[model samples]
Target: MQSYDVRRLSEIAYDADNGVTAELSVVVPLYNYADVVIEALNSVVEQDLTAVSAIVVDDASTDRGGEQAARFLAQHSERFATARVVRHHRNQGLSMARNSGIAWSSEPYLFMLDADNRLRSPALSRLLAALQCSGAAFGYSQLRWFGEEDGIGVADVWDPARLSTGNYIDAMALIRRDALLAAGGYATLADDHGWEDYDLWCRFAELGFDGVFLPELLCEYRVHGASMLRSRTNDHFDALMAEMRLRHPALLCSSVVGVNP
Candidate 1:
């Protein structure tokens, strides 16, 4: 993708030299969601948090999803301080693409958003405020399932035990990038893609950074046949669970996984 500087200094946070400085960085890992990626970008642009940057990592898509994303950002360049696209030389998986974006990010807080999903209005501000007030490692927003509209899916308080049995927390969360880096970023799982987010949460628990669940609806999860989570059946779930247990035996089996005190 081509590079361009077309943003005003007043719109973005900056230091003495007017270099790009932001409190949050929204990293979007794009695959082949050309149909809906713009809507996702729109959601990010409409966020209540003004001091934010966006990075789109296109994972060598067969379609022109990356180009479309670049075009959208170019048109709405002023919405964010910095908006750029990263094109992978080859087709890498979601985890690698996300890690690439993470490496490019310099903000203290980060939000990992898939191309298929989007944040609700005012989500970033609310999540950030709650994260600061609660002194938690990350802020998790309650999100509803799109396409299904099966009411709202609310997350409970920081429950590490529940993570062992199931991953109630979706990957759509605002987290301290430093803490995430300290615990290691999202794991690359070949057997089960669904376990990646769960494994990351377990790692956070292992590192003693508890997640704070915000019960308000802050995002919408799009459901479709091409979704990564929907593709995983019950066949590998058991194996994935066993793998998580083996990888983080101390984290899962210990009495301190969810215990805050």
Candidate 2:
């Protein structure tokens, strides 16, 4: 996790006069995906928004992926308003990684881009527009799956009722900074690693916040053997769902427990 100025997550802060200013912050949480992280960075640079910054959170990756991403951002500095890589002292889960990104972010909007995924087109402008005009908490679009899996990911207009069944919205969405902060960001559920996004949305629903769905496919979701969902066990899934239902009783019910996503 080396950078031009590598700082632990605890040490990084948003300095308004530090030459990094933006309307949106793109947070890419890096794990062990060294091979494809550069592609993700490239996609961020290709975004159709100029008043945007990029933050890549390195969760103490064992590989050199974090370093590679930092170097890539440095090499393409002109593409973004500002770009930098932040490091964690140890391997935290995805939720904490995103939380670190949120802490370092100083923008009105935020977008979560997984290290392995890529945007198919210039999406920031359209998603930002949808979020701005609809007065929604966030904006999400249909995802076109690629890699080991090839198809369109399940997507639907924002429906708070459907959240009790399962999460249909992916993490790759443009969200209002204030709304996300008010919801307390993503949660880190013990033994329920991959459901943070669902939990956040459920919290939003409880807070009476909803997202605007854009039907156009704007991003590519990479599915492979290493996907977090693939490694989850049936027992873990049941426990995770039950925990979610318990935590979000207002939005979830006993009938929704053990429901697979």
Candidate 3:
């Protein structure tokens, strides 16, 4: 996964001589996670699926995280049909990193993985099947709070009404790239530290795109003090919430129902 121009992504648009194109693309965004980026990518390349593409987005980290990711992807280059790494010259926030990956992906379905998190084996398979069978725009599975093995995060069934209150959708879910692009990839929040995932879910609900929930623990959410959401101070949260309200008041409703438009 050597770094490319970061602008060549096309959906299943690879050359015929390159054999079958990928069906799914996993975009990994990293920033100064040299110690954990390899493990994060390993979880992806180690998956059983073959028609998969992994895009490593090195978010202009001040560390060796990008180099480590490139080397690891290079070692496992043969595992996927197509894989590549794209590096940012300057530090763009997570939202930009993911939005760039979305722009550069050539697959119908996508999974946005953080450098510190990992996907469980067979989880992708299930999520893909759910999306295909239901003809939904995206699907997410239950998550396990890593280190809290005795406990699990059980996601409720699909409820568009509930989505308006708060975001229960973890960023690890598999989404249809088309729908994502249609609604707009992601919003750039103030200081680039907004609740991007929550904003995305709100937008999806607004678009009336079909969403599904699969009741299976398919990913692990690593808990640490340095996590993006955790690193923010209470003041940040208050400011972000106020901004969210100002930007998307309709999404903050409590009894919103029926996403069909």
Q: What is each predicted model's overall lDDT from 0 to 1? A: 0.75, 0.80, 0.74
List pairs with backbone clashes in candidate 2: none
Local accuracy of candidate 1 as per-residue lDDT tens digits, 1-261: 101211110121211212557788888988889999999999999998867889888887888999899888888777777787877777768777777777766788989899999899899999889888988899887778887445566467887766655667878899998887787677777574556777788888877887888888898888778665466676665666667778888757533222110
Best by TM-score: 2
lDDT rank order? 2, 1, 3
Could you tell me which 10 consecutive residues in candidate 2 have the lowest summed lDDT? 1-10
- lDDT of predicted model 1: 0.75
For each candidate, give its TM-score against the true structure: 0.87, 0.91, 0.86
At residue 199, candidate 1 shows an lDDT of 79
Worst 10 residues of 3 by lDDT: 8-17
Candidate 1: worst-modelled 10 consecutive residues by lDDT? 1-10
Candidates 2 and 3 compared: the better one by TM-score is: 2
At residue 205, what lDDT does model 1 achieve? 80
For residues 1-261, could you state the per-residue lDDT of candidate 2 as single tens digits? 121122344443222233756888889998899999999989888877866788888888889888788778767777778676777888878988888888776788999999999886678889988988989999999998888868887889999898777788888999998888798778889774578888888899899997999999998888888775456567577778778878998788865643322
